[model samples]
Target: MPRTILILNGHPDPSGKGLCHALGEAYAEGARTAGHEVRRLDVASLDFDFLRSQAAFESEAPPPTIIAAQADVLWANHLVVIFPLWLGDMPAMLKAFFEQVLRPGFAFSYRPRGFPVMHLKGRSARIIVTMGMPALVYRWYYQAHGLKNLARNVLGFVGFAPVRDTIVGSVATRGRESIGRVLEKVRELGRRAV
Candidate 1:
């Protein structure tokens, strides 16, 4: 069956030349080839302020860009977030994008007591992280903490189910052939709508 998929290019650079950009394009290409509806959100191209206080986070109206991004999030059945790992975490722009878009009443609602209510229960997510280190080293030695936090803490907390991830490490050293293989694998993932 066809799915509504949103591919979020989370790279901080807006030049459309990064590996993350290529990966996102490849995914969208494969998805469209497989008969799926695909949408894209480029974080670098958006203009929005970062939330600085709890009151702002909970009550302030998001900017127009954020509102539009939230609409895309709400429209999709599946989400693909692609970013380059920086300082052991997602780019600051991507983090800000999440902060601005996943506002209260959109992603969840707070209760006087107990856990916040999740409004996005039916959706699914996949996070793809490109990094400078070996994938296994990031997974085992570093414990893949950043990836886990996004997949479980943020997405899962907002009710995204079965959140999965692809870690493409040693990106700086991968040759053309190696990168091509990775792109093919990601394309296959897109074809499967995973």
Candidate 2:
């Protein structure tokens, strides 16, 4: 079956040729070749302010950029987020983008008695992270805390089920052949719509 795939190029750098950008393009290419609809958002090019207060977070209207982004989120069945791990976590702009788009009432709503009501229950996500460290070190020694936080605390909290991830490590040092293999692997994932 065909799926609607939203590829978020989350690198803070605006360059279109970075590893994250290449990976996102690869995913979109494979998805399109397989007849899946694909849309992409380059986070670095978007303009939006950070949520600084509880009032702003709870009640403020989102910027136009965010409103469109939310619409994209709503339109897609599968989301592919590609970013470079910075200081062990996602770039601040990408995090802020999430804060803007996944606002209250859009992503979830609080319940008086217990857990918040999730609005995105039928969606799924794939997070791809590029980092300077070895993948095993980030997953094992570091416990992949940042990745887990985004996957479980944020995406899962909002109702995206079976959130998955691809961690590409030693990115800066990877040879062209290795990078090509990684890109091919990501493309296959896109082809499968998983």
Candidate 3:
């Protein structure tokens, strides 16, 4: 079935010419080829304040970029986030993007008794994380902490269900062939629209 997909490149680098960015493009290509409507949000290109102050969150109106991003999130049935793990976690810019865009009332609302009401329901997400360490090490030793944080805590909390992830590691030492293989895998995932 055709679906609306949003690919977010969360790399902090403004150039958008790295492994993460390539993976995002590959995914977008496959998704488009599969007849899905695709939109991309390059975090580094957005002109907005990353630091969210108490007043900002309390403010009724958020920045225009954030509002626009929220609209995109609402438009997409599937969200694909491609980012590099820096210092065993996501880049600060990516974190800031979530902090600014996934605001209260937009992504969620508090409930009197139970958990907060998730507004971004009926959506699925895929997180593709690139790291310098071996993939097995990150999965076993670190227990995929970063992936769990985003998949469960952030996206799942907001009602993105069946959240899936792909971990690509040893990126720094990977050759062209290895990178090509990874890109192909990501493209296949996109083709499935999963």
Instruction: Give lDDT tens digits, candidate 2, residues 1-194.
Output: 99999999999888777899999989998898999999999999999999999999889999999999999999999999988888889999999999998888999998889999999999999999999999999999999999999999889999998899999999889999999999999999999999
Candidate 1 ranges with C-alpha deviation above 4 Å: none
Badly placed stretches (over 4 Å) of model 3 are none
TM match of model 2 to true structure: 0.98
TM-score between model 3 and native: 0.96
Q: What are the Cα lDDT values of the candidates?
A: 0.93, 0.93, 0.91
- Taking every candidate in turn, the Cα RMSD to the unseen true structure, in Å, is 0.7, 0.7, 1.1
**TM-score-superior candidate, 2 or 3:** 2
lDDT per residue as tens, model 1, 1-194: 99999999999888989899999999998999999999998999999988999999989999999999999999999999999989999988888889888888999999999999999999999999999999999999999999998998899999999899999999999999999999999998999999
> Model 3 residue 126 lDDT?
95
How close to the true structure is residue 138 of candidate 1, measured as C-alpha lDDT? 95
Residue 122 miss distance in model 3 (angstroms): 0.5
Between which residue pairs do clashes occur in model 1? none
